[model samples]
Target: MISTLTATHIQKSYSFEGIEQTVLSDINLTFTQGQLYAITGSSGSGKSTLLHLLGGVDTPTAGKILFNAVDINAMRQTERTMLRTKNIGFVFQFHYLIRELSVIENVALNAQISGINSTEAYDKASQLLDHVGLRQEKLKYPHQLSGGQQERVAVVRALINSPTFILADEPTGNLDAHNAQALMDLLLDCHKQWGPGIIIATHDAAISSRMTHVLNIKDGVIL
Candidate 1:
């Protein structure tokens, strides 16, 4: 399997009161295509921070992230920005939908931002909404939907770009047990269908067990 993502000697830190707080240290890992991988750890375990660095959403204090063997962290800011927009999709604990947009509209927003026409974006959005079992709620605003339904919409939105990788941070953190399972199933379904490599930061053991491989992050390194 070809590697979709590669990281080596990754170190991230922030200065607080003239002291360096290292969130990650000497981390190395690779994620290949068609695999779902989970990073499980406690709340302050740097899992989310690692995910951000993997996706090029944040720069690491040191080391490199490679997508298709190209070093993302070494790229110019403009290049990395384009790479992120074109190659990666992200989801989070909260579904940050625009309050004014309906479900379908929210999904279409990603396509629109990527320069797709409104009609075509809407068509693809409709298929995704239907796939997520939310076709009936297409016209409803995010505020009008339940938490799980809104999360489904968020997932649909994440998949609209047809990205090469999907990075999710605590995706089920805000859901009830039933809803969390449903959301996890939906994510795996999409992962299978889309064939994008998945790197999820999750605390749930059940969710970790469902993935292809599990990496436990403890004290800034994967163990």
Candidate 2:
């Protein structure tokens, strides 16, 4: 079956002091496995907020988010977290690798959290590291690697669970031109191999131009 992540008329609002601030308004979208989607918008355009909602990181003030037709928003926090760990991968703007763990450990940690055998997780992590040319650095700590390498490790960590969807927020924001392109190339390579639904939030037009399924958000609405 084709797995899907659907957002239905989602609305998100925050009450600061006495006023209400809406970040996303009546958003509706469905993301299918094995496709890539690029969400492009300027700063404070609600791109990140929309991603957070879709990833089940936050509850929508109105409407519901369904994963495989079940309302995830209604699920308990624990259940939602479990669902996210097992089915959704996330690559953030900064590489959040544990400062103390070695490269392989960082990548395999996710799979281990999902209850995979340690040996199996490590083996898979090794192979993925090798694929991304990080095998030599597997035993090294995060601070020992370059910025691009750290981000690549983060990507592998996200893919460790073989999640059906990947939500990347400004993943390339910190890299230079060369490293940024290399990182994008690496992500596409992973996408081609793993066939996950890759949704990236980026302000770079050049990157967004590469995706066939592009979404532009403006003023909390899809344009």
Candidate 3:
């Protein structure tokens, strides 16, 4: 069965020199399985913050992030890390590919770290790369690839384990229009063919319009 991830009564704050600043407040959202969701807002509107909290990379000042009815925030750090590795994937604005590793190695590294045999991991990664049209560049380093190619490799890394969902933060922000659309096309193909839910945080309406749900936020509250 596909998992349901929900954020309830979420709030995030940071203290700066004895002053409290809030990044998100009373935010509540439920992500259904196998659907595309877009969180739309200007920068600082808490889109990225929400993704971080949902992904278990950061804790909320208040509220619980529940996965299949269990509170993820209540998990031990190591447990949370394991859950993230096995069930959740993240794509950031930057590709964040390792400079030293070949493209195939970059995608397979997580699977190998999770205890899969190296040969099995590489075999699986090779299949994903071929599906994403990067088979020819598998042995190339990050510097040898273009920006779009680098980002595609990052997406492949996220999908290595076939996570239940992916949280993408401004994934297309750094790409040109053509490349941005191309990236989205690949994501859509994955969503349909592979059956993973996608939650994308973006400022572009054109991109947001394609999502099944578009959530507009301002000053940290959904509109």
> Can you tell me which runs of candidate 1 are displaced by over 4 Å?
1-3
TM-score: the better of candidates 2 and 3: 3
For model 1, residues 135-199, the per-residue Cα lDDT tens digits are 79999998999887887787778778877788888877777888788778877777777788888
- TM-score of each candidate? 0.88, 0.89, 0.90
Candidate 3 lDDT tens digits, 57-173:
888999999988889989988888888887898886687899999999999997886778999999999998887678899999999998778877888898888788988888887
TM-score of 3: 0.90
Better of 1 and 3 by lDDT: 3
Note the residue pairs that clash in candidate 3: none
lDDT of 1 at 6: 89
Q: Give each prediction's root-mean-square deviation over alpha carbons.
A: 2.2, 2.0, 2.0
* Candidate 3 regions with alpha-carbon error over 4 angstroms: 143-145
lDDT of each: 0.85, 0.87, 0.87
Residue 199 lDDT in model 2? 95
Q: What tens digits encode model 2's per-residue C-alpha lDDT throughout 1-223? A: 8789999999989899899999888899999988889998888888888888888887899988899999998888888888888889988667689999999999888899999999999999999888767879999999999987888888889888888899998887767877678777877876787788889999887788777699998877898
Ranking by TM-score: 3, 2, 1
lDDT of 2: 0.87
Candidate 3 structure lDDT: 0.87
Cand. 2 TM to true fold: 0.89
